[model samples]
Target chain A: MPISLPPPSEEAEAENTLAAIGEFGLIDRVTAGRVQPATTLLGPGDDAAVVAASDGRVVACTDVLVAGVHFRLDWSAPDQIGRKAAAANLADIAAMGAVPTALLVGLACPADTPVETLAGLADGLWAEAGSVGAGVVGGDVASSPTLVLSVTALGSLDGREAVTRAGARPGDVVALAGRVGWAAAGWAVLARGFRSPVAVVAAHRVPEPPYAAGPQAAKAGATAMIDVSDGLLADLGHVSRASGARIDVRSGALEIPARLRDIGRALGVDPLHWLLTGGEDHALAATFPGSPPEGWTEIGVVTDGEPAVLVDGRPYAGGPAGWDHFVR
Target chain B: MPISLPPPSEEAEAENTLAAIGEFGLIDRVTAGRVQPATTLLGPGDDAAVVAASDGRVVACTDVLVAGVHFRLDWSAPDQIGRKAAAANLADIAAMGAVPTALLVGLACPADTPVETLAGLADGLWAEAGSVGAGVVGGDVASSPTLVLSVTALGSLDGREAVTRAGARPGDVVALAGRVGWAAAGWAVLARGFRSPVAVVAAHRVPEPPYAAGPQAAKAGATAMIDVSDGLLADLGHVSRASGARIDVRSGALEIPARLRDIGRALGVDPLHWLLTGGEDHALAATFPGSPPEGWTEIGVVTDGEPAVLVDGRPYAGGPAGWDHFVR
Candidate 1:
């Protein structure tokens, strides 16, 4: 269980609001003493940042997260939210078989938001970026009634062909790296007002994406790859449609962790549903022509058929296999 | 004057809301017929976008615009808002002496928003980017109570060194490119509830930054440079502090536009004040070692003194030189 800290004192709160120090002051506070990697030719404190793209190509993607829609302050700390935002975009770069170089953030929040919260968010962003040898090179901030974080991650392809969804062949083996269903289980636990299973809850707060698996898969001659952000079946559906192939997941292949099984038993639900339909674990899912490299588990296969995702040669019974922003 | 558009019919509104079509549906509609520039190796529908960065370096920047804070739907159309957002970020890239290659957007809005409005915004972003041979490479959409647009622009320096704010030397000439104070005048007209002066209002809605001038200045051996987004003096203050030099603007060199003078006389506010303190015009300000290149007007000189920006060798009587987001 997460230890709930005491609320800040009145004096501390008064002195730490964004409005108290103004935009420039807040910028200085957040960016001060941060070290950037060599890839950042020029970091913040300028009109723009210059990042090295030695291979003559850059991979880029953007992700937006809102307060109530993506996370709640009561459920996760500001740092966790920031890490999640950065991870989501970085995974996209990795999915393209590129190494992350830098990130640019556009943050909007109410003026009265605590400076400490913004600082923590910045720290988390830096820490996560640093993990991949990338830098938070530049950003902009604005005042808004709702908190919104927009992160754009840039990566270097290093002269390799980008692994895309369209490359999956009919005779490819589907494989996955990194955890799945943990975050969804955590969500279920939190929704039921229970936080005792700290592992699941922590997974929900910050994902451990198999970032290295992306480029490794590419080097290992993987044909297609995608970071599973919207459940395994839903994301594979993308590959199926793009490559004009059919994908079928073998139910016997996916190993359900004991922790998740116990939670599912207690909740009177099947853990298989979570394994197949849950999202936000940011696992790397790929199609390889041969046996996948070590660290990747074979879970499915691609074949010449009507473009669709099937489970054991049939459709899954679980209702709605993924999260749709507008629908749910 | 901006033409008053008729409100959408109830049927049209109901049929076009974002929730009605869903996320993937909206993505297909907006990106279907659009053509991407040659710089985009892999466009939308992929996990990430691959953009050419042939110069071995990429310039990047992000800017966020909020519904009520940075823009008002009543004052500007969705297309105009999108154009402004794109232009703001692209201008930052230009200020770094780079040619824009691509853009990634992170848009958050209420689920009830009309798809027509969102399409218009995408069109505007595409139109503005296309003007400079750039493309909208990738983006994300999310649901939120407030509308937020976060745009990240990627650019190529073509092997030229970036003109940063920390390179101005004593005795360097300060030059400017593009209009100053026009957006502020337009903002003032809008604030006063008048819209007949279409030029100013349009300027306020969409800034016309001199994109080519940045590279021109860099090629001409500019020592330092910045974008005039936070008023001339206020931005100059940044350059002054960064370069550790005093900059003195010769007030006579700044020619206040006749239209602005007329509006100023009518509004009982001095045009000079607007020229000195206006923000968001996205003009280029640079310090050159010698006589500035063609299309740039020399308006000030950098000198050895305490780091500060002065007008006519003294601080202007204006209450404050620029905008502070939190302090209004």
Candidate 2:
């Protein structure tokens, strides 16, 4: 057959790989046609980005997600992985009771990676940031054998004092907002070679962190707060240690979601154990001197004692307390 | 040699690895006994750190350093690698005429990495931040096969307007602060298996960016500025494109340091060529309407022409213009 050429558009799309387009070209492709929020005074392309810090204070945090270590490409799409990475850091800013303003990403991947994959990641990051009125202000990309993303989130306190993990008093009530254990339950289902329970599987793919609830709890006189990225009991243990107080969680108040319970029953497991020890849901947990704000459920109370986390007045027997990246 | 153990201190030191100490333990070891500057409203251990952004706006940027791509462990010590990573991001903030206030790092490495290596990296980061009265405010760590560092730097403009790269005018004089070509020369030397000239090799391992000159040039009325991270000609190309003007460099103005000249002679290469196309020294280059600021050497002028960088009124005829992480 004689040599034939595709249309110009088709040829361009076919040539849109990282090595083909190069670093600058990939950057332009990903950042093109994006809209930044008002908080972003200056966006990408410059040496650095300028962002508004209206309260004279900025809240900042970083999270790293490595392929295979944090997620499997076969399990989640590029956009979902990007959203998860962005959510992980943005939730940290929220956990400090601040309003997110901007994010800076550092991506390292193989040279053969597709431009479309990077664009999808950028799209997901932008979508998540836009949900909180923030922007992806600046980032850098380089070549590597493994794909890794480092996301840094910056936020404004809006002139309010930061609700630190050390502020909970003995009389404060422990409350929870958003979902917990759903992602873990999703992981269990997926590990068992079943994907029918779309609800939990989708949860595993993307966490729906309660971003607004953090500021709500702060405005409602929350003494201490944290993002439940580990397990409920494990994260509560952090609050207990930081506040130098004892916490007793009432297991009956957990109330596992119906979907998780059904999946657990199908998988021959107890949903409550997942609720107590599962992680990656990015839920908001806090201590309130009085009643928690709307959307928060009271689950426990802080008591004057040594720093420890107890379930129903005693330690609960569970498989593991929480997730640790490195084995001891 | 009976089966008697050494002292408890010696035993503990020998067992200090990432896997043995775990994630939280490593965090504690690195953060313990460190003093944060006043700009750090809150430091590590919380979900996020609160930093003082005295100005209404904050300058932020991120840079990624990958092992074997950005630096080789055998060529540079862990501390030097950390400083290089931190300096790369901090210089970007300075390029925008901002004073760095804080850094957040995201590290991914093998589980078998030593705690001592991580501590060395943290020490280097802290030392560099302290030089500018800043702090290592927050960071995250994870396990991966390859080591990757993503550092985000946050800075304040001190109420001055940012000197963006798009502001260069037709009648501007181009100037430079800090050294260029030194790191590239050092890399050449190292590649040739000669480590003698300690000066250049040290420069390659750890760059001394003229951070103070950035805000000084801004105060002295620089029209545009950029961090010379890619190469003098290549980075100036960025200024030309961003500002929509042409820059012509007087090759003789870029004086070849005697040390580099000697090394180049021994290697059968022209040091002037290195001066034009070498990168990674993180020097600051800027444009001024009138006389350049003190400590800045004027080497060229911006003219009304197509966006391009020229050497002696013509294109440079030496080698590739700059470095790119991926091939085109």
Q: Summarize candidate 2's per-residue lDDT along B8-117 as a digit string, tens digits.
A: 68567657779888889889998999999998999999999999989878899999999998888889888898889889988998999999999999999999888888
Write one digit per residue (lDDT tens) for candidate 2, span A225-323. Answer: 999988889898899999999999999999978888888888899999888888899999999999998899999999999999999999878777887
Stretches of candidate 1 exceeding 4 Å from the true structure: A1-12, B1-12
Clashing pairs in 2: none
Worst 10 residues of 2 chain A by lDDT: A5-14
For residue A297, model 2's alpha carbon misses the true position, in angstroms, by 0.4
The per-prediction i-RMS, to one decimal, reads 0.7, 0.6
- What RMSD value applies to candidate 2? 3.2
For candidate 1, give the lDDT of residue A88. 93
Candidate 2, after superposition: displacement of residue B264 in Å?
A: 0.7
